[model samples]
Target chain A: MSERTGVIHDIGYRPYTGPREGRWGIVAGLLRHGALSTFGFGRSARSKVLPFGLLVVTLVPAIVFVGIISFVGMDSELLNYAGYQQVTAAFVSLFVAAQAPVLFTRDLRSGAISLYLARPLGPAAFALVRWASLVLAILAFVVTPLVVMFVGGLGAGAEVRDELPRFLVALAGALLLAVLLATVGATAASLTMRRGLAIGGTIVVLIFGLGATAILQEIGREQGVEDAAAWLGLISPFVLVDAVQHGLGDAASSFETPPDNPTTAALMLLIALAAAAAALLLLVRRYRTRGSR
Target chain B: MTVIQTRVLTKRYGGSKVAALDSLSIDVGEGVTGVVGANGAGKSTLIKILLGLLSPTSGDATVLGHDIRTEGEAIRTAVGYMPEHDCLPPDMRAIDFVVHMGRVSGLPPAAARERAADVLRHVGLAEERYRLMGGYSTGMKQRAKLAQALVHDPRLVMLDEPTNGLDPAAREDMLALVRRIGHDFGIPVLVTSHLLGELERISDHVVVLDAGHLLRSEATTAFTADTGHVLVEVLGEDAQSRMGQALAARGVAWQPRGQLLEIDPADAPPDALRDIVRDLAAELGLGLVRIQPQTGRLEDVFREEVPA
Candidate 1:
């Protein structure tokens, strides 16, 4: 009974990979999933209204304002063009970050996750595919605007020789921020099957992470530790983006380069990576636990 | 090779002393194997573990030669599962959902699409395949779920309560489908349901799970055998008394039971009981309704096995 079955060499095979291919594989997967989910977004009457209402109420106004300002011929130079980048970054973060948890959380809790798990897929594959999908969704909501801003900056007679580097820097910063947030959101969301809990929990963490600076300030003022509080403020990816943009300059504005603090920057990067990794681990643990149940 | 094997497979929830599957060890060969148990009999636990969806404590098992502990990914790929719950994504179309499942099972883009269509058609959902599953009846949803499981062409398919919420007519249809899947398609199927009589009707082999323990596993035919008791009915005045007197005069062993006479046809040829009853009825100018051999039902065996 214990004898081995005949080996099917072509079976259980995965292809070899290079770094660039792997990254785009993740990217393509995310885009496809995001597009598909867009069609299946509303399952219940209440959910149907909420997301559409949010898009109309929150996004429509911002999109219109961006359009109006761009057309008004206001000194493109005075717009703190970096502010536009930040706004776009925030939009991406908010949309992608909050959605990450809802993706798998709802499916699993509803027992829809079991449908996929019973197939040829495993935990790792499931997570990766989902993460890729979320990143693309974030791109649609967040990254597109930054690209528009960069193109606008170029059309306004901003020297490509000078402005191109800043645009690249801004794009890279946005990618890093979105990836960190999406990874965290997805990992955390995968911990439960309850969509409401997952979405609410992700929002709460983002709010805390965003507001950690102020909390630290109150603690510092009460305890007399201003410098440490200031440093703690840098823990936020939002603030980290601010620092990166502040250092990198805009299409129209350049500042004296500040000395790079390698240790502090490395520590912050490590923290982001760790949070993302922890979320993934928690999700894996959740899948294991639910499977057992 | 055995399609499934478990050694003392047990699972406990909420720290209760009554295990969901009390040291269940069973082997499943090719063809449809029906699992029968009451609502809380741990039949679901056994299916879940075999599909690598549940982790069994204090036991070792394998499905399709893949270890349940380490090679779950392989087992899951090779086995199809239809859960008892209403697990369908209501927003998606039936064909779309099944196609996605096929892709998840490692089929390439074109192949998954092709297989999805084939499966949906096979499950009798060809016309409604494009409709959102939310509007489907319980029977339609069951077929859609079954379509997804069959989409990947798995070696073994485990359907947990496939007729759970179906009407009697729908249930009979599902049972027929199960039989065809096993015999016609030649796929080994493991289906679970609390309806013992239903399983007896369709299943080639039946395994009874009682309170997380294996009560019995045997061929369905063997489980429901013809008892020697013969049911004799005759039409006349004082039918019971006259029947009894005739059997006594012939010195045949019998008992008066309700409006009929019961006889133990021991050591008699197959037609001997019929011959005696017919001749006696004719001589007494009595009309005989039936003289059939008494047979046990699957429900009777279930009751006898688990006394309440």
Candidate 2:
């Protein structure tokens, strides 16, 4: 037989893998998948815009009232940078915690997660990429507000030039809080495919953590144990940011002695980072064992 | 060598008395291998397990030399699967969805997009691929599903009920595409269909599964080549009666069946029977419309194996 006939015989008159194409394997897995799943992120963005718009609407009235008060020559710090930092931490942590299940669990329950798992990428990479995108989204929600507040404070002439360090610290603290809450919510949501139940579960978890602190502090006050009551405030995400803000401004920390102190701040940072890492591990494990024995 | 091999694979659903797939073993080689079974015959179970989408309760199977248990990630990357249900995210466009699937199979961005376009065109969805799949008709949706399976360009493609929810023309088109996928493209295609007759036409080999058990597996030719009857029809009134009388006079083993006469061609002398039947039909002022041999149809085989 001729060479061509031999090749045809090798092809065996059956379906052949159309051109033997070259691939770089898993190293390129991330870039290629990131490009493809851009559509998924686009879909997620479309779903988030309305709620984000609602949040903007809610903040608009406050922003306008603050602007009006500043414009009327009131000798007041309506755009107080430190005060806004407290709002930033509260909103970022609570909002991310409440919304994580909506953004994360819906994809899994809809079987869209199957498409990702079916890819050449492993569960570890998939979990990390998804968590990263979620963290970026949460950061946008939290950081945008803080940036606006900083500019507003400058415009309000609250002598904010000397307070740049404090503002920067607050920004970093808020970002860490946002990332931590987003990861926690996403991890909890990953345990179940049902979005509503996952969201409800996340809310209950956050409430339990922060609510118990508030209740403990109230009871401690009744028992006349003021120092013990103060310790319970550490559970609140807002309190952590307030502590950091006060520490940056040379004030006694609300959370601990010197919020920027290597020992105390490092411990807090470790706890937040550990939560994020644990959440990532849980998500990866769930992805690996999905629908399997 | 077997492209796919399974040994006693099984799946038991929750609270179910019987297993969905019970210790079933089958081998598939390259070509169009049609998996034939009725509803609830464990066809879906087998495909899912082979795709590594479902974990088996026991036993083992391998696809393209990849173990079904631990090597599922590799198996999935190498194999293409078109699920039976309406699993498509309807809001996405066909091209985008197929491109996404291609990327998932490790295709680079440029190659995935190029293959997606080519596959969409190949499936006859060139224009409709731009529209969201939600607005597509059933036939179009099936074609889109088919396009995604082809977009990845894997070594083996498993299609589940590609003709489901299709009209006759659409079903024929789908089957033709399946045949071409095997014959024209030289890609091994394992397709499942509840209709055995359809599979018989397109499949080089057919594997029959009946209630979680292997009923039959052979080349389509082998199962169909053993019919004992030949049907003879004459083009006139009373053709049946006249043919019956002629056969009886010759002592040929035959029976009258509806308008035509069914005769065991083996028992009758071939030349003499033909001449006698012709002469009798002519003498009775009738014409012989046709004389043909009959073989068992796949549907008949299915009915024999699983009665409903």
Candidate 3:
């Protein structure tokens, strides 16, 4: 056999010559990607069905209400800002229940959490950014209709100066509702890797809590324990948000009165905030351990 | 230079009586180092601890000068890891998954995209880069996993069972790629396998683990060095007996080893022994076919060192 020499060819494997934006860059990229995923952007058309369908369902009522008020004139009985969340609470709840799994459970099931944790970002930052993404998406879902109503009421020649303060209060209530619902939904979804289980758990927690509390309050009312019945509203997330709205003097039109006194309203607000805080803690703790293990 | 160092590393899983890893210490340097062990031998546990994904029950380790306990993130940033299990997200396209991983490893957007493409091509997956990972075959998936690990240009890479599910042809291809990663690219590679002899051809050094205990650690050449015994083959009826009789008549120390005569060159230099064998074969009218030294193998080392 003749002697032979090997030839070297350049395959163009270049070293990275650019800046590596450390932890915050990773967090930002994950946050942006997660937010887009929540609304089904950058995914197949089939993924858009539930989130967009719920969104359109939520917006149609606002559009029709605006059209009616535009033609029928601004009566005080028209759908007010504070009553918007109460009217659409079910749609919002279903929206969160369905979409929260898209944000939390999918990663766990797919083992994508390992990829995320392998980066410069820690587990706490990963959880926080994922939670923030859902919060912003749900916040948009909750606030969009309210903004439309405020603009519609003004376009219908309702006095802007008088409606403005109530609009601001409604906006605050919607923000609070969005945060609390998001916290609860994400925490529930984080508990399991199965999307079906996560959705069922979230619905049972929110809807069952509402149903159980409503029954207890009715019994309290029949027994003439007015104070106890008022406090029972704090157990359900929806009733608690409504109570907060009432405390802020922006009670939904369906409520005959605000929660009997300021004490019940204050307790409801504190309890909702505390529950949300606890859920947030649980989410962070879960990711911290699960991501590493 | 040492790329990985562990001192008295021990790990006990929750509620488990036996430690997964028990007082294991190892130092690995640059080049291809193969970690060989059986199933449930703490290979995955050791990799996880080195990556700082799991804390050791006691003791400590360092990867590329960063403490595994305190600077896990820093260590992760510098060392690329391909896990043993199927951890890829099925929904993502290979390009997107690899680019996102590059981003997560701290590369900027444009650089990440560029590097992802480069690494994909390097791993010989350029044709399937655009396809979703769910549609990939086992070989394709392994290549894609390898692509993501190399996208960030890490100084050290830990590949766990890269050829676990490949056919013989694909296993050869994967082993070649691993050899290229260590030799051509000049990057340190720490690859793990359960098959003892599979890594004998590529690894510069080999470390064997049995039941989480360090069985042996040595250079590949050392493990497979010549055993100083020459096997002689002859062409004739009853060739073995003829060769043994002829060699014994010449005062050569010889024994029968299967079909060949084993020659021990006692009190004679290698050259003088070869001359004596040649002269004896000619005088005895025996056709000498071959004479070659026996070499040790990684499997032999494992069999001798690890207790059944």
Candidate 4:
């Protein structure tokens, strides 16, 4: 051996001695990250257009409806809160279809789920966090326009005291719609790693369900089957939201007349709940089994 | 102390008749342990099972004293894993990805960011950390993967095929970094490779698996223990044969090993045999170049120990 020696200089790789939060902190971080990804926060500017554009599209009608009503000095009661959701249902569906893949499919396609699962967060927690973010995103989309409209009615000199309760009920209806759309959208996105396929699948499911249920309800109406027509409305999430709104005595249905009886409202609520739960369960199972791989 | 222990562990895929790991058992101590095998010899499967990514078909294991069955989360929190495949998100910058991974491992945001920067620098990716991972070279991607694994400051790290696609110089750099992780930082490292000889230089202990069965597990020194033979080189013409004949005439057993003469000290001690060879070469008027004892190699052990 040669007579040479070497010294190792310190590079300062200090271990993290700081406080480490537990599972809840991890879940919160993942939720925040997923929510940001839904709107393409950390991504390139080109990626931001679709989700935010649809969001703007969702808000435009509310702004125009409010602007026109305020400027024309029409009855402040002209635009109902629940009726706004019905009118904007297409925009909301498209928003979910476009953005849900950003949250769900990208992770699966890029193998980022492995990194996520390798941490303290379990597969169920991962699924729940993503679902929560999608719900929050859809909620923002649905509730922002309604809030703008509510404020516009106030600015137009509408009575605040009488309108506040209806506004709150409409918020509830909007939340229900957000949860339903999030579940269906996230479930569709979770089934595939292809973004285009996921978007197509979500749009097809929502639109086909709406069109099919409307045609079936028309057939029942021609046959004079009252209860059957009301029951058929449950097939579509849009009609289901309308049925719930009708039960709350807030707004009238735009597609098919809302169910008249309490039993129909209960059935619609039950079916919606079951579908959301089933979709959530599918998500949890899918991640639990395939996420580890 | 044992860092990882498995007892009768077995794993079989859904429709396969052959088990990936068949009732295998091993105890790995706290140091750099090299897991070597040919393709489909269950090296990756073993690492996956240790990380609690894949559940065993039977039996059990523990990493850092946490059960692989019920305490998978706990095990994962303490053990960092660098997978063999390309698992990084293409659109995300390396710094953001590493910071996010640090957060997922439970570090607070500020601490995660600080640690991410430090680990990136330590892995020699400080300048490239700001760029998106999609544009990174294979070497840079491998370093980024290594940085994420170290960012958590885990008790033990399991690296799978970290040198898979590197050139020779990069391979040496990575091996040196692995040695530093185990020796300088005093962290336990469990690294796997399909090539047996690649790990021979840095691993303190080597475990060889053949067809999912344990072929050998021993200290690196034990595998490379000295063989009782000294190789002799000379400068004269017909040097090897001349030295061999002269040594044999003097009752010293010797053989020609290529250009060098190998002297086997049958019953004599090495020092005495070396002196005898020196004297004999001087009297024979042969120019003695060098003489040194031969040490065993891992390739020799493989050829001698592995069953056909």
Candidate 5:
């Protein structure tokens, strides 16, 4: 036999006399991994199938929307950021519902959060950082296509002057939607340690909220209750955000009767902020009391 | 140095009348100190309180000079914890998970990876470190958990049942690893066990807890040191009286109990007393059953406290 070609050295436990990065280092590490795990990185190949598939599903429509504007130069309703989100809401909701538990439930289920809390990061900060990572990932899902459509349309000869304002409005809507979706996801997922249950719960909130409100608003309008239908616009996340943008005079409302004054926009904004804050508080409490142990 | 100090720390689950940890105090110093107790003895609760995973209902504690209440984050930064339950993410490789935990313990990425590898090797998982942890054995999983705790090179490590569910050989290996951490590396270790026998050999100090109360906290020697007594048993119809009277004739102080004699072995050399007892029994044509020194075991410490 030849002499040994490999050696496994027992370096023993050496004092880590090196620099300790403390809180921000933990934050950065968790955030980076948390965001990546949303897209199924650092996990199994089987885990990658869903998030990557959702990204492609989300991207294909974005590519086609830009293609239609470029080839036909059609004055399409699906030309703006909020409009893009409106069209892709189902796919984006599916993505968030399916993947949010990847970040939220797996850690809680495995009792890994206790180890995390055993670090310098507190339970509240842990929840927030995890919330931020999902926000980043969902933003990527919403923005990747927005960027594609913007550049692709510009390449197809759409004027920047005509498109820039609409682009900015959609950008703001995407941020708000991402934040709302992430908060909902964290709230739903952290409530249970079961991944399937968490995913189903998030789907119910994101999709059920949008579906129920949209259907009710349509029925209310057909029943000649236009006031009620418009008020129903304040119910779901996407329509509520659309109402806000419309109130701000940037986009038309998805509702039959759009908000005519800025007061409704301000009121809706306040409600949205309050709701998001409540959901975030739930996440923090869950981490502190249930998830950490 | 006292690495952990607690005073009147208490934890009570709301509905349960019995407090999990009821007004307990202990000062653990710079070596392997074993927290020995039976099931539901609040060992895990104590660990959680120290790690700041659960807040105490009352009183105060400090870990590495940081208050457990206000400075939980600082204590967490300086201390590593190996939880009793499963905490490893099964889908990830050992190296990845340990590195991730190292970062969570506040080390930067490169340092985290470097120390992760070193600690994994130290835990004897170097060969299998690249495999997903779900595929590993229980011993491997335990070592992986230990590796994450040591990866940050914490000032102290609080391991909850480190030898739990291991076969005897594996338990021996883990205890040795724990001793090396406290002794060779000079890092303080607070290890818990349900069995006193396992920790008795490795721990420099043993703290016995019974039902949310401290039974005793003392050096290992205080628990195991020999007392100045020896027991001798002789076999015969009237063995007890014959041996006692024979030892008295030989000027050895002795007390007769059924089938045995308790000798103080006072003044005379212990070996001499043993020889005389043997010679006396033989001359009396009696069967010498046994001669033994009565050294205190850590278990005896518990038995003494709860004598029936």
Candidate 6:
């Protein structure tokens, strides 16, 4: 065995005099690895189970709806581009919660992050790259089913003019949802080292934020506070993105009393953008103070 | 070239009065330089500060000509650090982890994989590189850690207690690898160990630290040079005392240590001392077993009284 596999070209510790891609390469490398790891690509078989299972589970609804709508020529608004994700947000949230720790918490918990920070990549860049990776991963989860739906709808005889525009709008909402969920998931995972806790915390924060915001919006409408109810949409990422879509008149509202007007929608989109920026800043600071120094 | 130069580097955690690394000022040159100290003697603190992973309280240092304060990332880019603690993720394969580390240190993807294989083989982790590191023995894990450090082909490497949990045979294997990294591979190595003997066998220079203070920093040859003492063992009744008396008559300083007499040839040439001892042994009717010169040890640095 040794003879067959012996190192014939053991050139012995040659110093790399070639060109380095520098810090950009480092960022790109980690970003790719983090994204793949979220869905357990490039990892052990056991790790692939949960992520791929959740992914298949999420895509099932899109496939079933598309199959029925295509063959029967029955059109339902529920199978619309943005409406599909709005309905299946639970599985999407579950997928992010289960996988965020794979990228964010494992290194911090195992002290493997010190190895990463030992490079030229600073803490701010490290956190940002990781956050970006999650955004891409979550985008994959939300985009796949929508793409399937759109293709299936077109093949099932939907008009390109009507469906294409709606598909683009849904794609935009998916991107927004991706960024918002990535921010929330990465922040929650970075808070603690415990894997189960990180997963639990992310799911709770997302679901509770939506539930609490809905209650507040309900209270605001009951008290006849229209502006406060629209603003309260900012508290939950699900409602905020949904409210934006509704206000733009692209997709139907997921919430009761969504105040479906262009003015409130514009305000909600601005609040979402501002909230995403603030969350990114907080995540970077969290990593910095942890001495990713 | 000087690999590391620190000036009054000090580190204190939180509101604690005692510093982890107190006023440490040292220069590490090329080849293997061993940093020796007990646990909490600031060996780890010094490595961390030099790597730019920790901020020193009130001093400055330069690694490979980059100032630690302003050019920490530049310094980190040029140096590879193997932390003393457990840094490996259990579920990852050794090859994957090392390749990832190479990429993190800025190597291109394809090169990272190639260099990862090379370094893992160099560290004697070639065959088992496919296994998850969690299943590895302490020896294999340490080798994996060392492989990751070398994967980037770093200009200088700081290994904090690489022999921490190795068995005797494994420790020998590790020291030999460290020696090759410094001597053959031509990468300047700063390896640390609490055991002086291990470092003495491999390091070219030795820096001793005790309780956050610099005890001594000098060449290994200086620490382990000939002590001007000749050991004499005689086989006869009262042969040890007789040899001692004869050596004293010849104006030699004699100290007995368990059936062997160490005679210092004060101002006498080694050959002259050997001739005198030969004649004295014959005249005293003692059978001289052997005469051997004694070399000092790095351990004696700790045995000596601390200087003010």
Q: Over the stretch B1-308, how does candidate 4's per-residue lDDT look in tens digits?
A: 88899999999988788999888888888889999888889998898788777889998899989998889889888888888888788888999999989988999999899999988988889899999998998899999999888888998999999899998988888988888888887779999997777788889999888777887889988877888888889878777777788888889888777888877888998788888878877887889889988887777756886766
Cα lDDT tens digits for candidate 2, B1-308: 57899998888877677999888888899889999888989888787778676788889999999998888777777777776766566557888888877766767678788889888877899899878777899999888878777777778889989999999999999999999888787778899999978999999899999889888888889878858677888776666777687778877778876788888877666787777777777777888888777787787776686767
lDDT of 6 by residue, A1-293 (tens): 45576456646667788777787777888899889988887678899998889889989988998888877768745467766666777788899898999878998887787777677786778889999999999999899999888888778877788787778888888999999999889888888899999989888978777788888888888999867687888877788778888788557776765755889889778877887899889988887766523
Candidate number achieving the greatest DockQ relative to the actual structure: 5
**Model 1 Cα lDDT, one tens digit per residue, B1-308:** 58988899888876777788888888888889999888989877787777777778779999999999888878887788898897787767887778777666666557677778877877889899988888999999999989888877888889999999899999999999988888877789999998887888878788988888898888888877787789899988987788779888987888876788888777877597789889999888899999888876677766787879
| Cα-based lDDT at residue B247, candidate 2 | 72
Report each candidate's C-alpha RMSD, comma-separated, in the order given. 8.5, 7.1, 4.5, 4.6, 3.3, 3.5
User: Which candidate number has the best TM-score?
Assistant: 5
Better of 5 and 6 by TM-score: 5
TM-score of chain B of 4: 0.90
Worst 10 residues of 6 chain B by lDDT: B299-308
User: Scored by Cα lDDT, where does model 1 land?
Assistant: 0.69
Weakest ten-residue segment in model 2 chain B by summed lDDT:
B83-92
Candidate 2 segments exceeding 4 Å error: A1-41, A44-48, A51-114, A122-132, A146-176, A183-293, B12-17, B226-228, B233-249, B255-261, B283-288
Error of 2 at A283 (Å): 5.2
Candidate 2's docking class is incorrect
Is 1 or 6 the stronger prediction by DockQ?
Answer: 6
What lDDT would each prediction earn against the true structure? 0.69, 0.69, 0.83, 0.84, 0.85, 0.86
lDDT (Cα, tens digit) per residue for candidate 5, span A14-106: 788888886786798889999998887888889889888888888888788788887777764556666777777888888988888888888
Single out the weakest 10-residue window by summed lDDT for candidate 1 chain A: A12-21
Report per-candidate DockQ.
0.24, 0.22, 0.52, 0.56, 0.65, 0.56
Model 3: per-residue lDDT, tens digit, A128-227?
A: 8889888888889988998888888788877777778888877888888888888888987888989998998888877787778777877877788867
Question: What local lDDT does model 1 show for residue A92?
Answer: 44
In angstroms, how far off is B123's CA in candidate 2? 1.5
Residue A45 shift from truth in candidate 2, angstroms: 9.3
Give the DockQ-based CAPRI class for model 4.
Answer: medium
Worst window of 10 by summed lDDT in candidate 3 chain A: A249-258
